[model samples]
Target: MARFNRKGTTKVLFVETIADPGYMPTATELGTAIDYSKALAATDGWSIENQEIETPDLASTFVAKIPGDDSAADSSLTFYEDDVDDDIETNLAKGTEGFLIWCRKGRTAGSKGMDVYPIRVASNSAQVSLDNEAAKILVKCSIIDRPLQNATVPTGP
Candidate 1:
């Protein structure tokens, strides 16, 4: 297998609602999602952690360990402030519930992807910088659940 850089491989889409939250969204549903790939500057967090259970029994000197429930960490998306349209700022308001479809290996057909249906909330407000830097806004997402992970990218119409 050949190694490739992640330069032009990520795609982020924000959708207001999903017909069924139990299953992976269809291609038609993904197509209607608002594409925020261009506006996104950086992404932080979204780590999954497993609860460790330690069993210290008198039978053995070592403690037996087991994994318990899994939890997803909160994530943040930093988007370049678009003063001309203000699209990112308007849509990603606090208390907004939406699904964030993140294509880690590009959204092309047969590629790997992950869909996270998280509620949008404000983490840190946009910072104003006097130095030569692009103004960016951070949008926090509380991941309540994950509908799909490491799924194949479906072909879109």
Candidate 2:
């Protein structure tokens, strides 16, 4: 999670179905989520939505434009994941079809030997399988956050 410049601020842009969020967002709820993202982006700036970065691994970002006048458009949202390959697209498609879009990709570049990255998610695998609850298992098992640099040399398990 990117930290806010102002301290203790976190941008949490969840892309779950309305069924998961439990209730529809009131004006107050929208304000809270939007405000949080803007606050966090002020720090290091929000990464592109539904994308990942390695070297220093990162959570995904979700793009959003806070509903308002045409002139007021916001951008980017943060999400957690198991690994860079997890599909965050289905989460984006949930209830808001044309209203929003989630761009899912991974940003990989490192030392010469560490640069070769593999696409781990199966072509047919659905994004919902990587929801927070499921990813929690991968995180807890430490499989998703594998040591990329360390794995290259293979100093023997």
Candidate 3:
């Protein structure tokens, strides 16, 4: 197996239209690529919970467990604040906007190390300090569906 590192990783986000659930923004549709890798510090939060319930049977000492509904994927992204336009601040300000995020984790082409997530930005906040420290933004988002793993990058318009 080949080991991958984050040195050459890249991340892009595409705004999705509200009317069409199947609408995926293409490169031509997007006009310009919005790369957030520079400001993005971390991509954390992807979880699935299977709620198990124990059977209430008295005959058996061992209880039988049944799986319940799976919980939605909730994710958080941290970004290092910057002054440039189209940066984290601008993106986060687009509250409740649906977005598709592509995260590529390999340096070379043909590398099959990518993850695509469909998400809606739920909330965002930034902190400032008097000390000589850079500002940071924390964005909380909820996944629309299960993420596509090792998927090809979306084609351009």
Candidate 4:
């Protein structure tokens, strides 16, 4: 298996935590909260991709892709303290505040990809924090590729 730096690859904050606003919402709560609205937008609901599961891994993937010709093969990404489970989210932890994401220190010409760190939300109340009060996370990620020697290199001369 190939190793990657946690500072220079594609990073995506999938789901970005389910803790909506007002009150942190459980997955079920999220369903209920959007119930009325979804119903109202039923006609245009096609835009909404609504497949839910009890597992956060299945919740949704907020893709953070690095624009390029090759994905995955050229870049690698990781999530730091990416998990905000019930025990930690509600209980809090020593080194985690919000969430962190790390990218490989450089780019790849073959492919760029992101690795997901599972976040096991233990409970609704403990794991979920909604609204403005919800933990604000700052995701830092980058795509550092050696300048394409042959590709168009636009520069100010």
Q: Pick by TM-score: which candidate is best?
A: 1
Per-residue lDDT for 132 in model 3?
Answer: 83
lDDT of 3 by residue, 71-149 (tens): 6556888788776654566656646665555656532334454455567777788766688867778888877776556
The window of 10 residues in a row where model 3 has the poorest summed lDDT is: 18-27
Worst 10 residues of 2 by lDDT: 137-146
TM-score of each: 0.86, 0.21, 0.68, 0.16
Q: Which candidate is the best by lDDT?
A: 1
Runs in model 3 deviating more than 4 A are 10-12, 17-32, 84-86, 106-114, 129-132, 154-157
Which has the better lDDT: candidate 2, or candidate 4?
4
Error (Å) of candidate 2 at residue 135 is: 19
lDDT of 4 at 44: 10
lDDT of 4 by residue, 1-157 (tens): 8775543343222223334332222334222221111111111110112233332344468543343343212221211222434332332232222211111222222232322222222222122346544333222222222111221111221
* Tens digit of per-residue lDDT, candidate 1, span 1-157: 9677666777888888777656466788788889888888888876677888998999899999999888877688898997788777678887777788877788777787565555556554686789899998888878877556777777766
**Model 2, residue 5: C-alpha shift (Å):** 3.4
Candidate 2's residue-wise lDDT over 1-157, tens digit each?
8322423322233322122122333223223221222212221122222232323224446544343322211232333433664434333333222111111111111112221111122222222454445331110000111112211211211
Q: Quick one: ranking by TM-score, best first?
A: 1, 3, 2, 4
* Per-residue lDDT value at 100 in model 2: 17
